[model samples]
Structures are given as C-alpha cells and as structure tokens.
Target chain A: MTRGFPVGEFQARLARAQDKLANRELAALLLTTEPEIRYFTGFLTRFWESPSRPWFLVVPAQGKPIAVIPSIGAALMAQTWVEDIRTWRAPNPTDDGASLLSDTLNEVAGNGQIGIPSGPETYVRVPQADWQRIKAATKGDIQSDGGITATLRAVKSSAEIEKIATACDIAGRAFARVPEIASEGISLAQVFRNFQGLLLDEGADWVPYLAGGAGPDGYADVISPATERPLADGDVLMLDTGAVFDGYFCDFDRNFAVRTASATARDAQARLIDAVDRAADIARPGTTALELFHAMDRVVTGGAGGSDSGRLGHGLGMQLTEGLSLIPNDHTELQPGMVITLEPGIETGPGRMMVHEENIVITEHGCRFLSPRAGAELEVMR
Target chain B: MTRGFPVGEFQARLARAQDKLANRELAALLLTTEPEIRYFTGFLTRFWESPSRPWFLVVPAQGKPIAVIPSIGAALMAQTWVEDIRTWRAPNPTDDGASLLSDTLNEVAGNGQIGIPSGPETYVRVPQADWQRIKAATKGDIQSDGGITATLRAVKSSAEIEKIATACDIAGRAFARVPEIASEGISLAQVFRNFQGLLLDEGADWVPYLAGGAGPDGYADVISPATERPLADGDVLMLDTGAVFDGYFCDFDRNFAVRTASATARDAQARLIDAVDRAADIARPGTTALELFHAMDRVVTGGAGGSDSGRLGHGLGMQLTEGLSLIPNDHTELQPGMVITLEPGIETGPGRMMVHEENIVITEHGCRFLSPRAGAELEVMR
Candidate 1:
C-alpha cells in the first residue's frame, strides 16, 4: 500500500546526498533518524516503538550508499535507491544490534572522519557501550555535523511538493466534513473522533495530530478535554490537524463559529485570517521567511490581537512541524515547491481565541495555495 | 486529572537515581528525554510537535532538581516537587527559545561535568547552535550518557505498576468490546475507531494505538492502516491496543474468530495462547527475563498443541512496549511491582494470526495478573 516515491527520483536524491556529503568534507555520514533516512533513501519507518534494531544508512563521500538494517527490513530497504544492503538479526537477543551497526558503520567509514549529525552537542546519546565500540572500531576522528543532511532536505523537489499538496488536499477535505458531524450536544472527544475518522477515510496514512480547544471564555484559556465541558452555542472551536499522506504532512487549523455569533469574535477571527492571507500573498521566491513572518505579524499585533502568540506558521513536509522554523533570523528564502504554513493564531482570553492557518507553496512566479478552501474568513459550522 | 503516584514513593526512586549517578561518576544529570525527566522529576510531556523548545530538569548530584521549561509550562512545573523552575518564552515573534534554554543549562552546570540523559548518542540531538552556545558559555564537559536514568526507569515502582495495571485494564476492556461492535459490513478503520473509543471511554488520556489485520488468510498483523477493507466472515481478527491511563501505557493484543471457526486457525491460536500463558507463569519475582522467554520458547518451538512459533513477549509501561525485553540472554530479573507483558503472537499467513497477551506485575512472592481478561483461548464472535 506504500505508493513509494519514484525510483529514478530517489536515485537523483541519493546523488544529491552524495554531493552534500562531499561538500561538507564528510567521508561518511550515518543516518539514524527516520526523517534523515527517508529524506535521502526513501525508506520510512515507524518510530512509535523502541529503535533497538538500528537502521544506519552510510553515505560515503563517494560511491553507492550502503544501508545497514534489521534483517526483517532487508526487502524493504532494497526498494530504495540504496543498493549495498547489510542485514543484522534485529532484536539481536544479545543486545548486539547497536554494536553490529557500529561495526558496519566502521567498515564503511574506515579511517575517514565520519560525520554524526546533531553532533556531540545533542542531548540524547547512543548507549554508552555502543559509542565506545564505534569509536574503538573507527581509526579516524568521528566528527559530528548534521548540516549536510539538513541542507539537503531543506529544499523540496517537485515530487515531494506533490505529496505535500496531496496531503493538504486530503486534510482540507477531511476538515470540510467536520461540520457535517459536529453538532450541539456532542462531546469534544466524539467530535475529535469524527475528525480523525474523516482523515483516515480520506486515505491518510495517519493523522499526525488533532488538537483543539473550546469554551465561551476566550483565548486566555488553555482548552483541553477537561474543558470538554461540551460545545455550547456561541462556542469558538479551534481545531488543528497535521494529517500525513505518503509520509509528507500538512498542518492546518481553523476557528469555527458554533451556533452563535458575536461581533468581537467575528472581528478577531477576520483579522487573524487576514494576517495569514497577507503572509501568503507576500510569500514568493526570493522572499526571506522572516520578512514573510513580519508582514503577517503586523496585521496580527497592530490589529486587535494578542501580543503573546505562538509562531505565525512553519515549514511542513516529512515531519508535521519541521526543524526549519518561521521566526526572525530564519533567512531560508521562499522557493518554488517549498510548502509552508501561515497560522496567525491569537489566544486572547481563557475561552476566547481564533486561529487561521493555510498551506501554501512558493511558486515560480508567486505562490500556490495548497489548501483549496477560502482563506481570510471564518468557516461558520452550525 | 493527573493520577499522581504517591509523592513519597517517587522520593525513593530519586534516591535510586542518585545512587546510579554516583556509581557512574556523573556529577549531575540533565533530564531531556520525557521518560528520563518523568522518572527523575515526575514531569510529563506529550510526544513532540517539534524539538524547537527543549524541556529539561537539571538533577544536581546534591541538590533539588531545577526545571528549565517553556514559560507557559512554569505553572505546571510549579506543581512538581522541583522548586527551582526556570522559564523560557516559547518561540515568541522574534526569539527562539533554545537560546534561553542553553543559557540556563550552562548556568546550572557551571564548570562541572554535566550528564545529559538520552543525549546525543541516540541520534536525536539538541539543536547544533544550542550545543555550541552551551559550550561557549561554560567550561563544563556536557556528556550524554543517560544510563543512570535508563537504569532507574527500567525498574518500576509500586505506583508505576499500578498505573500500568490501570492502563492494561483499559486495553483489555477495549479489546473485549471489539466483538460487540465489529461486523462483516464494517471497515477495519471503523473497527479501529470502535476499539479506540472504548479505550477513551474507560478514561484513557489518549488512544495510544490500535493496529490489527482483518481477514482469514491468516496472520492478522499490527501496522499502520492502509485500505479501508471491510471485514469478512471467517476472518481472524487481531486486535492490539496501547491504551494509556495516567500517562502509563499497557500494550495488549488478542486474536478473535470473526464469524466462524477454521480448525487450523483455531489450533494455531490455541497453541500461541498457551505458550503466552506458560511464559507468564515463569515471570515470578527473581526469574530472569531470559528464563521466562525460554519457558515460552520451549512450549512454542516444541510444537506444543501445534503452536511452536513466535517470540514470547517483552516489558511494557510508559511506552506501549519498552525496557528489558523478555528475549533470550536478557538477564534482567523480575522484581516486585515491575509490570511487563507476555504477548506470544503468531502470524502464519496474511490475515491469519493468533495472539494472546497479558500484563503481569511481579509480586514479593510470585506475580499477580493485572489484565484479568486473558486471550489464552480464541473468542468466537459468530
């Protein structure tokens, strides 16, 4: 059921990975993170369980890459552009999988300095024994730098963009059905289930997340299920979904007017929605992320909105919320096919708040709205 | 709504953590990973949207711990035993929270070797610049060997056992309800929803996971959902649930006869179920994990009742599955109040599988069954 990314396109991605490693002066870069592995190798795995069985992709500065994976994953690994595959008995009964992976990494790294992304500065370290074994086996200094992979994955290709677009479409359609099921007297939990069911029915591999808050108070409140108290008339429902398709994710959130209407709520919602639209409008190739963020911020802060707010939006793809953020100093210029979200959310009071989010891809000339639904207006759900 | 484990008991757990750190020569451990943080400080955080903001508890060797969390979390931190709470504004319009976190960590470590739990060795690292800033700000050697935390968390407390038991009960109830709602006309997706709904109704903080195959070809597997294939008569329905109650999760699986009986499927199911039961019998206090595993292996591999196949089971708690797995050579002994699961699952073919799982808590004398409902025999829903 995994409609895998094209083989030729992935081969091209591997080539790009090789170039990145070479440019970074890395003899070899070991990929252990799922996103990094999927970025270069097109191999996706679930991380919900323990990673006792390590999957390390060795991208040498030169030559075809080798993937050291669990024996169970051998067949799946072969589907990737990576050709040289090494399989070790996973669940190694002897706790030897990590050591075996280290051995494989050492064999490929040889005396060349290998790069460890997230480097020595990371918080989570490998098992102490494994680290010692890897170091002992390798003669060269093990350098740490994940920049090579980060830079390579930061830019999106046409195929990757297509997946993001598809994910957005699925999410939008799922959202379009939310109002159909949500009604007075339904528990927030039930509504949550309905939203999730819609996403799954729409062929989403999985719904990354569905978080919401509701009540009559206002944005000043932290709305959780305990606040589940029920969606009464005039309740503002803030729902956010990070639905994934083909491993790519699209994040979308919208505040819905439930049963009742208030001028203040409508005005606030309009302003936030306008901010997101303005942000997307200013987003084009060559525009810096920070610049786009500021344009959105002006509408939010200047026009009756809360000063204390979360980031306007963020880059979305393999990970629902990617590492590359959308705050000041993030100089990653808008590029065609690189999809990002613009969410100007405001939590003014405990039970009052409004969030308007949209997914957009920077296009050749300007920008393309991945989410087909209208922006800058509240979608009243009665 | 936090089912708090008695605070006094956690004090003893902290003492145990201190003992491990002292033995390991770690000056003070910085708790970054959620499991480690929860083990040491009883702090809980959900999986992750992104690693943009680092939440950590600095457990000094000889002092009360300090919580370095995002500003909004300050109030929540105040509820914990730790009093030295430092807050970093979660990504404001212009600031990245990582900078503030690094500053706090550097200040706390102050020229001393700092031990970071679940740190860099695990492939998941702190942001590069954050690491650099910490190093630049102090002369302290920050090491990422979270072994102390791992060792501490591996052994469950009485309270932890209770929470796990609660989780297992929820999971069992979820599994038990499957037959009541599942029908030939219903899609596997709907079945999944019904199972999850039961878990939520039973007070699960979140529906951890529900994955199982639907059909009679044989091995009903556990994986992410794919096509919305409807169930059919004579299908072997395998249902596995990771239902969390009070932050602790119990992973349990069961096999049911969808509509009628197949002699082969029934026999296979019986054998697998018996193997799991025998394995649980051996999981008394002082029994090595390997011993329990061997017991199960002996029954399965010897073709007892025609079910000589599949690994025995593994440990379970906060994660659906984790810590000191019950595989061969894992010498960790069963201890009083330690919760674990025995799931001997056999998948003979596509949609043809038999699985029986149970949650057991080792007692001072032997063990107590926390999951009252056993899947030792096939449950026919014809």
Candidate 2:
C-alpha cells in the first residue's frame, strides 16, 4: 500500500463531481478541509495536524484542481496530478494565500455561483477575517455546494473500497492479539496504550482515534479518553479503534470479558451481533439509512431507538465518521459502493451498555463485511 | 501523567482572560476550537479527531464559562471545572446545538460586544450557514477578540510547562533509540513507522506530527512524508517529531549519519546546532521574536534570512505549532513562561536543506533547554 490513489482515481472523482456541479449550476466547488482536498488532488501529509496554515483546492467545471498552498508544500503538490499550483511565503500576517486564492477563484469561477461544502458535518477552515477578504475579492458568488461533494464521496470506487479494506484488515489483525496485553491486572490506560502498539505492529499507519472503557456491565460512554483505573474480574472491556492505512480508516470494535463473564453481558453481546446481521440482511441497493437503523434498533433496543450517542453507525473512509448516518431521521438511500458501519448498542444494566460495530460495503444485491466478524460469544481474557 | 490540569490551573487561566477581557471592554469571549475550549476548561479528549460535531464555549465577563455541546460529550464535560454545561442530542440536522448556543450567547453577552478569537492563526470552526443563523439569533455584536486569548495562551503556566517538559523527555528518549531501528539498508518509511512505535513505548501519549528526509548532503523539504528509499552511506537522515504527553507538545528534530559522513553534512550539522544555541543566548524576558530570528538567521544564513518554511521556530503547546513565530516581521515580545522552539535551517546544496530544532522556555533571566540538547557533531547510525 502507498500514500495516495492512482491518477485515474482522482480523474474519475473529478468527473463525478463535475457532473454534479453542472446539474446544480455551480461553476466550481471550493474545498478547505483535509479529506476534501485530498479527495480531489491526492495530496496527503500529516502536516495538517498543525492548524497554522490553511490549504485550499478549487475544482472548476472542467479541468484539474488548482492548489493555492504555502511555498513549502510546492514540492509535494508537484507529485500530485494538479498542474496549476500557486505558492505564498506562508505565516504571512499580511496575506496568507487569501488574495491568491481569491484570484484563482475569480479565474476559474468567473462571477458564477461558486459553492463550498457548508451543509451538515462540514465547516469552512478559513478564518473569518480572511474569508471576508476572499469573498470580497473573488468574482464568484460563494454559497453552499448543496451536499454535492458529500453525496459523491459516499459512493466509493473499487480502488477506494480496496484501500478501506486494507485498513480494516490491519485493525482486524490488531484486535485478534488484544488478549496478549489486556488481562485482569492491567490498567485501562495501559491497555489503551499497548493496544495502540498492537495496531501499529499489525501495520496501521497511525491510530488517530482510540476510545474504549471497562466496567462490570459496560462503559459509560464511547468517546472518553482512557483512565488509569485497573481492570478487575467480571469487567467487560471494549476497545474501539479507527486505525488508518493509506489515508483510509476502518472503524470497528471488539468486546472481551476479563477473567469472567456475567449472564447479562453474554446475552447482550450475542444480541448486538444478531442485530448487526439483521441490519446487513436488509442492506441492499435501494434501502434507506432509516430502514437499516430500525432493523438493528428492533433487536438492540426492542424498537425503542438509539441512546444519547445519537446514530448507531456512520459512513467511514478517509475519516472515522463521514457522509450518511444511521438514524431514524436520516433517509439517505444506500448505493452499491456505499461503505458503512453497522453498530448496535444494548443496555446490559441500568446505566451501562455494550455496543458492537462492524464495517461493511453495500453491494448490488446485498452487503458484505469488510472487518473480520467477531463471534457471537465474547472473548474471555486471562 | 493525567489527561487534564488541576482546577486551580483552569481557574487561574479564566482569571487572566477575564482581566484581559475587562481591559478590552469585551462582554464575552467565544471559543470554538479544541485548544481554546480546553485552555479555559480542563476538558481533554481525543474525540476531537472526528469532525462530526461542533463544540462551543462561552466565557462571560465575570463568571465561569458555559459549554453548549452535544449530549455525547456532556458527561466528559461535567468532569471539568466548568459548572454551566448545556447539552443537546447531536447529529441533529435540524438544530444541532445552534439555537442553544445562540441563546446562551444572548443571555451572557446581551447585545454587548461579543469577542471571538479571529486574529492571525485563528479560524472560525462553525459552518458559514450555521454561523449566519447563530449571528442572526444573537443580539450581541460579534467581532475579533483582539488577540486576548492568544496572548494569554502564549505564556504557559507552571503546570503547563511541566507537561511540555515531560513530553520533551519522552521524545528525547525516543530519539536516542533511533539507531536501533534506523541504519544502513533500512527503508526510510520503515524508520518512520518504527520511530513512532519507539515514541509510544517511551511514554508519548501520541505522535501527531512526524516528518523528515534522507539524502546525500541534505533533504529537499522538511514537511514531505517518507518514501520507500533506503538509507545509504553519506546520507544525512533528519527526523522531526511533535509528540504529545497530556496534551502538551514538544517540537524538535534529530539528525543522524548513515554509515559514512561527508565534510559538508558534518559542517552543516554543527552550524545548525550553533545557530540554535546563538538564538537561545539572547532569549530573555524582554527580547522580541525578531531578535531571536536574527540571532539564529545570522548563524545559519549569514544574515541572508531563513528559508521558505517561514520561521526559525514557533510556539508549541496544546497544538503542534501555535502562537508566536520567530520571523523578522513577528515583533511579539518574549515574556516569562513563554515556551518556543529554536529551529534554524541551512541549505547545504541546491534545493536541499538540513534544519535543527530545540525546545526552550524563557525564564525571568534567560532561557533553558527543555529538549535534551543534541551533540554538535551528528550521530552516526550503525
């Protein structure tokens, strides 16, 4: 595996986006976030961890995308398929590529309707002061892209699916070795640390997001950082990881019974896996996200719906969570190439719950699992 | 050792920001980014890796800050020092905490001047459409915070400095063990993956940013990702990392020679370290950032100026690179408790440069090195 997609992959993405832009009557689509930029130009770098510089990619109605980036990144951008690369001495207080970006927007868009991805789950990465200046200088009318990019990004190509499958394969190998470092005596914090090491050893590029918890029944929530509390007997330990390989992510988790298991946890784990398979059974080309949500909700919650964490599963690829979400209100129609997670949560006790998640891609007739599926019975830790 | 600061630390930070807000006549300060929200409150989590939800924090003129966040984060936010935490079931496309945040802003600011950190190096994290709606719903006047929070954040607290020093210690140990993983015949990409594992093994909570290069005399750029090229004799391998421990960052790099060394690479290595030490000599309570840039720039470039990476060094703490930049144009004055990196780059050949970086803190008298100072001569890998 390598860092970026092939030249044809980006070109195919551009064609799909251009068709959508034309139908919406938008001249160009402006991208400010990392995944959005990388989706168009195949520009990948970990330097985005620093919020010091803002990068821009403008995809016109016809042609390759133009990159208005810092001078330090010109060499890397050259390696991509993008031809017209503009540079600036960045960290410039006066104009940090603002006017340059505005000029590029004017040249490509030409007073037409220029769109930015400003719908749900998206935010413009530029500063307000600079955004105001760029808006005034650009000849195009800047507004929302009406979810064009999000819709196009939800349907994965064969290469994109392959990258995501590679990421899933890496996480699957890491999860199989969890019992080696996680036992009754180790602390949850140490387990989290050692688990991350296992993911890297199994060939993950980086573990960007890792959150799990351990308790008698289940974890309180899914998003909290690890604590130093020691894992005790009868504890139900859950480890959820969004490990990346080749800039694609695999979002899934595994459950373990530390030194023991209760009847409630055993039943809950089995029900969670059953709910996931039930959802997969109805996951076809024309099914809506709401239908999948209800299929799993019936088994997990007795049709009561999800808990406070909101959605059960979400689309994952370049990010841990993206695009369509599985909830009662989300009615996004599933497509052939749409990759998503089927996560089902069961309330084991009063305030504790156990959640099971697996990655899958919807095929023409049904769906297939990307992650190595766990058994119905929870693994027992020594 | 812990995920967050003490209550006193957050209280002291709020008090300082309140004092500054009073001086500027701003009724309230709005914080949207992760670091800004975490600075005022000890709410730390790796959940920020997912851009699914937007979080907001409002600090009033006199009282504690108010959190308008998703219900998924309410439990974690409650553990912080904050008292007023407002929650809404998130991923709600209809509302998504916008109306609640606007109402909170209305109650606290109330048609008064509501300040947001919108100066250089700052960005508004909310979507433009949502921001417009929030702006219309609020009665307060919204504009820039006039660098109030940035100024306060630049000067670290005693607890903050201790966390950064611990992170530096972990990176120092990781760099010392590089020869075990990196040597002649080993690929650069393998070195990157194994080096990150070493950082984690040495107690780094996470390694967010890692970039370097290997070439005959020097590398072309410092920010590009690693390639598959194996190290050879006379290659100067540079590895820079911004590893984190308890949310504090240590930004520095180490250089090593593969098997054999040339006179040019050896001389450039010593000169780069000399440039770093020269800048540290004048780093005191009253010196300006420009003065530090000149001291290092003189030694590296012979008064010609720094390379296109923009600055010799920058402020690092919560974020990989933040706050002040050591450039000729940046005239921000250094003060006690200000932590920065002294990084100087020297061009050894055409389009090739080798840079040296060291983390330091300015005391009341002078500056002290936080990262272990590297030897004047480059280390030789077996």
**Positional deviation of residue A375's Cα in model 2 after best superposition, in angstroms:** 0.9
DockQ, all candidates in order: 0.28, 0.72
lDDT of 1 by residue, A1-382 (tens): 3356777876777788777677777778876667777777777544334434456677777777778766646655666778888776555544445566667666776777788666221232354455556667666676665566666666788888888888888888877887876766776766776676677667666664666766652443232332346778877777677777777888877677788756767777777777877787778889998787788778867643233344567777787766445666567787776778887766555534566778888889888888875544556776
Q: Where in model 2 is the C-alpha error above 4 Å?
A: none
> What would the C-alpha RMSD of candidate 2 be, to one decimal place?
1.3
Model 2 - which docking category? Answer: medium
Superposed by TM-score, candidate 1 places the C-alpha of residue A316 at a distance from the truth, in angstroms, of 0.8
lDDT tens digits by residue: candidate 2, A30-149 = 999999998999888898888888899999999989999988889888989999999887888789899999999998999899999988768888877888899999998999999888
lDDT, candidate 2, residue A315?
94
Highest-scoring model, DockQ: 2
